[model samples]
Target chain A: MSRLLESFRIALRGLVANKVRAALTMLGIIIGVAAVIALVSIGEGFSAYVSGELEGLGTRTLFVWTNRDAANPQQLTTADAEALADPLACPGIEAVAPAYQQGATATYAGIETSPNVSGVTPEYLTVQSYDMKVGRFIEQDDVDHRGRVAVLGSTPASDLFPGSAYPIGETIRLNDVPFEVIGVMAEKGSTGPMDNDDVVLIPLTTAQTRLFTVDTVRGDYVVSSINVLVQSEDMLDSTIEDVSAVLRERHRIQPGDTDDFQVRNPSDMVETVTGITTTLTIFLGAIAAISLLVGGIGIMNIMLVSVTERTREIGLRKAVGAGKSDILWQFLIEAVVMSLIGGLLGIGLGTAISQIAGSALDMQTVVSVNSVGLAFGFSAAVGVFFGIYPAMRAANLHPIDALRYE
Target chain B: MIEPVIDVRDLTKVYQMGEVEVHALRGVSMQVMPGEMVAIMGPSGSGKSTLMNMLGCLDTPTSGEYYLEGAAVSDLNDQGLTSIRRHKVGFVFQTYNLLSRTSALANVEIPLIYGGVPRRQRRQRAIEALEMVGLGDRLHHQPNELSGGEQQRVAVARSLASEPAIILADEPTGNLDTRSGKEVMAVFQQLNRERGITVILVTHDPDIARHAQRIIWVRDGLVERAEQVGDRILADDSQGSEEDKGQAVAVAALDASGTFEEVAS
Candidate 1:
């Protein structure tokens, strides 16, 4: 320990001897470490942003859409929805809400606006992960009785019912027929290319009978899209398979013929998106790691210069009975110290940069503790790796030659 | 009757500079007893430095038997040579080679550090060594802060710090003024007389050589003459001794007459 302390003192003295040169040499290391941290953090933030956007899609929700024969363009129906909701055939399937969407004009207080209106069951809120801020979603009684009721998303509610005190319970005319607003959905931020909280919801029966009135609905009453809620995430695959099999049999598709419905597993979507994010994070990390490599090279360069500058000192120490290992360790310690300092400074700078980016750009920046560990570990390894040549040079110097050096 | 502290028998040193070999020490043999003060006097290029280097264990002779306190130093490796240099010899270079950045006290403590002395004990010993050389007040002063005389004194103190059996000084007073040279010579004489440290000094100055109890004059890598002064003269009736005595008397008379040719002859 004393020898180690003495080595530190000697190294410090060497650095002190050439203050400007040493500080300048440390600059490369500092910048490199900081770059590693900052780049990785930003990459992490980007990935986090992507994952949070995916989470907006909700968990345990499955999307069943019509698998159009690119040649045929077939739509799904209410019969397919009923088959998907069969409890005995598809156990653990919670609720099946079929959706039909159409662009239609909504009127309130002499003002008219065209918005996308979706017809769905009450279970649609849970399946699509919607929370109502005021009033209630379209219920089973509303669907059975074909009541002329509607639910507004936050944006459409404000747009259609301007100056109204709480748009809920107000009547909004869809295509000139008055429908009472039963609920207003809470705001859901943009996910990828979709603004989820910018539309209207009404009972499927009401939308079918009043809005797009066709008594004997053809093709699919469900309008080619259905949202399925499974009892748990673990039962999702089986539920999808069960739903697909029932839809195929209902559509009368023979074996080897393409089915008319497409099952989109939300978990699979999450996995694919998460995989992409993870890969992107790693790619960014690898780029950031280049800075670390540069930092290591900087350490090695500085150590080599130090060895050259302290050649006489090394000789003196050896002449005074210090062994080869002692000289080696002294130089090695100096390199390690330099790299560690750089690593720590980099981490601090990186975190600060990440925080600034998170607030300024409205990104979700997450600094994992493991990344810190990895950065430090990498710095230490760099110290050892870069220190080897200089340490060897110092250790190999002859005492006599060193003493003779001016 | 004391054992010889340094015993060199037919020591020869050859230096290979490119292709030509320079025989620095062709064949040199000598002995210095404990407490003896000996001076090696020669002209420039007389190989005095090479001989001094060998005695200091800083260089090995090409072929020789050098028994320093009965241990063979000629065959020792680098580490062994370092041990011999550290524990058995203290060297005072003509240039007063003190580390410029270190204080006088710290410079004196260097050998003790190499000797594995603990910090506190080494400091105390260094201070005592400085005091012995009358530089106790200049302990904290660096080599550049001190005069040539004081720096040499610090070097002397450093030599004494290890408590070695032999003090090897290569022109210890060469760089000093007359007064400082006398002062340094006085210290060397005192140390030899009081501490019983064997002193072997190399010098081209005859005045400096006069301070030693014995003088070994070297010419062309050979010990040309050895003279014992003070109390080593023996009362003898041998013819060769009588002739040497007559020559000595004639030289003394010429010195009284102040005749350059007579003294030179």
Candidate 2:
């Protein structure tokens, strides 16, 4: 035990004697570890952000879309949505909202902006979990009577009426057709390609008859997509099966034939996003790990030089009765101490950088405990691995030859 | 008669340099009694350094019988040799060989550390060893902080810290001025005379060799002569004569006649 302590003291003194070299050697390890921590946090934060966005869209929700790649693609309509909404047809379904959408310019008092105009029924607000900032949403009476009433999402509301807090009861023209804005949606922010607040919602009847005027060969009104809300998370799979069966029957899809529609669970998108981000984190970490490998090589290089420089010292120690293992331990402990100190400093710098980036870039970054532990552990392993060769070289020197070294 | 502290018979050391085999030592036979101060004198390439290395247990002879403290150490492995060195052997070098930037006390403690001496005892023994060499006040001085003579004394203190049975010093004063050389030789002589520690000095300088009671002349890897010095000079330049002065003159005559076995007998 005392021998080991003496080795540590000797190693510390060795480092202190050449402070600039020691610090430079440790810099490689510090930068490598810091990069690993910072890049990994960025990747983790991005995945977290994606999951949060998915959560806001609701976990118990499923999207239904027409399979345009099918041999005989069928248009989705409000009738199909109403059929799926029947409690006996799809027992686990809580609500169904079929929406038809088109890009159109909305103008108010000579101010115009292009927004996604969606035609939806009263159930749309409930299915999408959107809240109103003012006035009321579309009612069943509005859909039945083809009322020219509208609800504006916060983006278009603010764009068309900047500085105006009360956008409700204002008359706006969509694609040159006039409609009254009865309500404005609360702000929900944007993510990726879809802007949740850049929209205007109107009654389906008015959209199908007045604006788009598109009718199928069988005289059925068409919609772009349908949003279905399950009663609970556990009922999602069975509810999808029920909805698929009902839709296949309505579209007259034959057995063994591909269906003309798709049912997508939002949770699957969350899993995909998580997988992509995790792989990205590993890739960035691997690149940073290359720098660590180089740092280990630097340690080995310096240790070899040290052994050569201290040849006479080693010989004198041997002459004074030190064994091979003692010499080995002294050099090995020196390398380990250096790398561990570097690991600690790197952790501090990494966390600080990540926190700075988190605030500077307006993105969330998480420096997890697991990552810090892994980085520190990896640096120590690097020390041991690289220190062995040089330590062995020092230990194996013939005492006579070492003593005679000039 | 008491057993000799160091006994070597026909020691041969061959060095394999690339393809040529260079013989460093050839059938060298010698012995030294306990508490004896001996000097092995040789020119460069005369194998005195190799002989010193063998005596110090830092290298093994190619083929020989070496009994140190009456134990045959000729065939011992590296571990056994290390243990023997730690317990029975000490070495001093021409360069002082003190660890640079280390305190004199710490330098002395190095051998004891390797010997696994307990911390408190190691410190106490190091201090005593330093004080023995009259470096009592210089215990905390580093090698650079000390004069050439003081550094050599510190090295001597280091060698004495483990209390080994024998010390092999290679040109103990090769790098020192005459006064510093005498000072270091004084410490060695004091240790040998007072502590009964056997000392072997290897040097090419006849003046340095004159300090030992016996001188073994080595040439061409062979023992050319082994004879007692007529008048040995103490480290303080005081001259003294041995009781075996008549026997030494006879040995010197036999060496002149090339009858080496008669001197050994």
Candidate 3:
């Protein structure tokens, strides 16, 4: 233990004697480690934000899409959504909020911009777990009466009514059709690509009867997709089977035919998206790890040079009684201490840069403790791996030859 | 009779530098008793340095039996030789091979550290060694911070710190001025007389060789003569010698008449 500590002291002295060279050598490891931690932390933060948002929407929820068979044009309707919501027909289903969306320009007092306009039922609020910032959402009576009322998300509401205090009583025109703003939703911010606040919601009956669709017929209607909530996470597989069966029956698909509709659990989507992101993180980290390899090579290069420069010192130590192993360990410790110092500094730098860049670029970055520990441990391993050859060279130096060295 | 501190019989060294082979030492045999101050004197390329290295255990002899304090060290492996060098032999180089950027105290502590001395004891021993060398106050000063003579003194202190049985110095005063050379020689004499430590120094200068009690003169890889240094002027040049009165008077008179060539001849 004392010898190890003495080695550390000697290593420190060696580094201090060649501060410029040591610092320059350590730069490689510093930058390599910093890149790894910074990039990985941002990746972790991004995934965390996404998964957290998904969890907010409930993991057991499933989205059913039509593949929107363009040739057949078999779009969904409110009747189909109601059919899936029936407990007797789809046993594991709890609620269904079917929605149709159109990208349109909304204007209020000449402030016009493109916003997503969604037509949904009263269960949309419960299914989405969204709360009103001010006024209430559209009620069942509004959907049944085909009321021309809309609930504006925070962004469109603020943009169209920048200075107005009473946006709930104002009228906002969606594609030249004016609708009274009945409520303003609380801001949900951005989750991945979807800006939750930059949207407007209206009743499905109003959207179908008045704003969009040529046919006014209610029985055979069209919607983009349906959001189904499973009764329980354990019941999800059976619920997907039940929902698929009901859809198959409603669409008149035979036993051998492949269904045109796509049924997906959000958690599966989470896994797929997060899987891609994780792979992307690993790919980027691997690229960053290449720099660490380069850094290790730098350490080896410097250590070799150091051994040559300190040849006489090694000889002197040997003359005094130092064994080959002692000489080897001396140089090896110098290499490790160099990189270990760099590794520690890199952790602090990487974390700081992560936080600063995160805020500056409006990105969410989380520095994982695991990545910090891993980067540090990996740097030490690099030191050992790279230091051996030079250490061996120092150890194997003949005392006579070394003493005779100028 | 007690075994000699250093016993070498027919030691030879062959140097193979790439394709060229050079025979540095053919066959040389010598011995020194305990508490002896012996100087091995030779000209450049006369193999005295090689002999010094072998005696110091820094290099193993190619063919011979070298018993250092009764241990056969010439046959020992590199590590075993290192252990011998560490525990039994101490070396003083011409350049005072002190570790640069290290304090005088630390430089003195090198051998003790290798000897597995505890930290507190190592410090204490180093302090005593430095104090013995008359650099008691310069303990914390690094080599660069000290003069050449002080550096050499620190080297002496380092050698003495281990309390080895034999001190093999290759041209100990080769790099010092006359005054510093005398001062360093005085310390060697002090260690030899006061502690009964065996000191073997290599030098080309007859003036430096006069400091030793005995001289082993080498030429062409063989000892030309092993002569007792008749009258040692080293302990104190100002005082008179009790032995070899006539020869000492003749040598001093030759020096006084400025015909010192006779002393060399």
Q: Judged by TM-score, which candidate is best?
A: 2
When sorted by lDDT, best at the front, the candidate numbers are: 2, 3, 1
Candidate 2 clashing pairs? Answer: none
- In DockQ terms, which candidate is top? 2
lDDT (Cα, tens digit) per residue for candidate 3, span B41-134:
8888989999999998888778978888888887888889888878888899998999887899999998887787899999999999999999
lDDT-better candidate, 1 vs 3: 3
lDDT of 1 by residue, A217-331 (tens): 3644656488899999888888888887887777777788787778887557767887887787788778778878987888898889778877876765554445666688889
lDDT at position B110, candidate 3: 86
CAPRI class of candidate 1: incorrect
Predictions in order: lDDT: 0.78, 0.87, 0.84
Each prediction's DockQ against the real complex? 0.16, 0.70, 0.56
Q: State how far residue B221 of model 2 sits from its true place (Å).
A: 3.9
Reported per model, the fraction of native interface contacts reproduced equals: 0.04, 0.87, 0.74
Candidate 3 has which clashing residue pairs, if any?
A: none
Off by over 4 Å in 3: A68-73, A86-89, A103-118, A131-203, A214-219, A248-259, B43-46, B101-103, B118-124, B134-150, B176-182, B217-225, B229-265
**TM per prediction:** 0.79, 0.87, 0.83
Write out the backbone clash pairs for model 1: A77-A220
Interface quality of candidate 1 as DockQ: 0.16
lDDT of 2 at A227: 97
